[model samples]
Target: MITFPKDFLWGAATSAPQTEGAALLDGKSPSTWDKWFEMEPELFFDGVGPNDTSNVYVQYKEDIALMKKMSMNSYRTSIAWTRLLPDGKTLNPKAVAFYRDYFEEMIKQGIEPIINLFHFDMPWWLMEKGGWEARESVDHFAFYAKTAFEQFGDIVKKWATFNEPLVHIECGYMGDAHYPKVHDFKRAIQVGYHTLLAHAAAVKAYKESSQNDGEIGIILNLSPVYAKSEEPADQEARHKADLIYIRSFVDTVVHGYFPQEFIDLLEENQLLPETQAGDRTIFEENTVDFLGVNYYQPLRVQAVENPRFPAQSPGDFARYYDWPEKRINPHRGWEIYPEGMYDIAMRLKKDYYNIPWYVSENGMGVEGEEQFLDAQGVIQDDYRIAFLEDHLAMLAKAMQEGSQCFGYHMWTFVDCWSWLNAYKNRYGFYRLNREQNYARSDKASSYWMKQVIEQSGFEYGGHL
Candidate 1:
């Protein structure tokens, strides 16, 4: 008979680049994705690109109705910066009108819209002008955030300045998942620093302005790191991974400063990001009102003496290895450790001042989902049901133990195009049948989710 508070939020989350398909329509300019797909379409899986998404631009009304039918009390999605500002400065009137109508309709349907300003869809013009590496780019992002707030402030009350800034830093700067890929360690640190500065500036703008009276936050994809063995070297590697991957942004946003050990390591290695005098003060005064955590898996790390990269990357400290007894999602090849969710809740309560937060993104993505469809066209996703049930059980236990978690938002509402993976992995309540003009059909999980939301919790062993 476990139950959640009556006010607990149940929602679904999506992003602009993954869902919105009208890439160049309505005065929308070229994002890095549009340009990247133009240049290197081969890099994208199955040659599918950004503009081939689920067509939310044309189907948003139907989608919102689906969300309402599914009993979603709230919805989270981002505004494409490219769509809003064609040249990085001016606000397109059409873009403004579209978002206003979009938010209003959700509100009318009894669903709260939580809008994120940036979701890694960096404007191509900005990328050409040095992107997050150039200090001035921070100001440009702040301007975008300000414009979004002023325009949509009347309709949308909850705002997120950025979604997974760490992904923007790691995947874009240090790996190949995002555009303008470079592997310079110092530049990676700079991108992280400038991104945080942009976040701080946006937080400050939201608080100072009288345009919107909503809470502002950032979404982070955080994971708990575990050492491979109980050795001194392995422990050191785990600590290093924690600092680089977790503490860098979390500490700055919550505690208003970088971890001293993190700074010391960067300084010792000459990889510290260049910063101005007033940046510290900005972070100090403009901490966020809440946090949105996107957890998928925990990290497993061991000390690296020989290291994979040429000592220039963060690889010198740690290297990843598979945990022996790990249960994996065969389709996505990602670890599925539900207990990590409990560890995350307790860590936040113990270390991060018990800040108000939520499971902003969590879901199971399976490949080749059509084979599971029953005669009624519902994808019988018992795996997804079990995956969510186990995680939600952990969440319930954590809440009972006094975590400040306020909500749980599934990864998405509909099957949409992933960044580089394209439609290789589908994580959605409704399966999108692209052959039928992106027509969505219910998966078994959708009805199950509605029951969970209606009951405010699910039973241990029951039909739902």
Candidate 2:
């Protein structure tokens, strides 16, 4: 049987706005998501928005108890900036008390809490100040990060500065799916640069502050790209995709600088982000202690003759050709490529000096998951169980070959609101009943996960 290291951490991840429903309660202010919903409620699935979410603010205690029951040794969650600093400056005492008590309870139950500072929920006021595109916003985020560390650093030692930084740059700035939807290449570059700088600044503050015992890192959603064929053009397409999506963030955060190739390409296109003095030193000195990888699928790419200016946000610099023959997650319209997980780990080993990392967010979201409930009232999520097993086996193979990955946290804990998609798809091991006051019930996958945690691993089987 395959097994993991003795200290392997098994847990689930959850973000604040997706789970905590007290949008306007307890002196909390509006997040960018709240404001977005107000502007375009119809954009969200079934008109459900950020205001409608699982009541984690009130039920965190019960949730912590449920985590223990699930045999989880760790948990990943984000603190809402709007909740802590209503205006992104003034500290809300009530927010502080709630967070301290919530974190304390998680620690008391023998669960390690890994906290993330930002998860796409910028304070509405910050967005009003041009968000990450403005230079001043970087300092504001750094201040928020320092405040969080100063307040809750004792219990939460594993801190992620931001979750999926590239996602924000792609969706919010390039694609029209997220808030502040602006399809501008120059703006995307600016926002992305500032986000990376903000991350570096947070790392610097963490080091300069009294909270020096903990590690700070960032989470990135990485999809390994493969050339559709051995053609030279296809290979070039794959490289361009990697440059924009993966290496752009990985190279800077881990190596403390942007890749020369990326810089050259930006210069050629006149799309370089505006930089300031000493920004280079901040990045060079504040490289992350660890990295978080969120992989769900591999990107299959082929070259195109004429790439468009506004290339669907991320694909702007490269052309994309689909793999029609690949196995598919019919429920979610994503490719099911378990080997991508192993490929990512191997890349980290060879290219990034094997810095310690973990699968921070990886799971399959199924549409209308409640329909899978059986006569006994249990959701038979055999598909999800199989999906995890396939991916975990790949991760296990990488670890045996010496990848420095220490933990594996699923995408989420409870079924909660997904941005734009809302509650249309559920990724949680524990299903939520929206009609019944957001009551949660464990699915078969939850019990299966408990077994995996208890055994520390499982026998390898062919991908489902």
Q: What is the lDDT of residue 433 in candidate 1?
A: 84
Candidate 2 achieves a global lDDT of 0.89
Q: Candidate 2: give the clashing pairs.
A: none
Per-candidate local distance difference test: 0.90, 0.89
**Each prediction's TM-score against the native?**
0.98, 0.98
For model 2, the superposed segments whose C-alpha errors exceed 4 Å read 308-316
> Which one wins on lDDT?
1
Question: Could you give candidate 1's per-residue lDDT for residues 196-234 as a string of tens digits?
Answer: 999999999888777758899899988999999999999
lDDT of 2 by residue, 46-136 (tens): 9988888988999999999999998899999999999998987899999999999999998999899999999999888888889999899
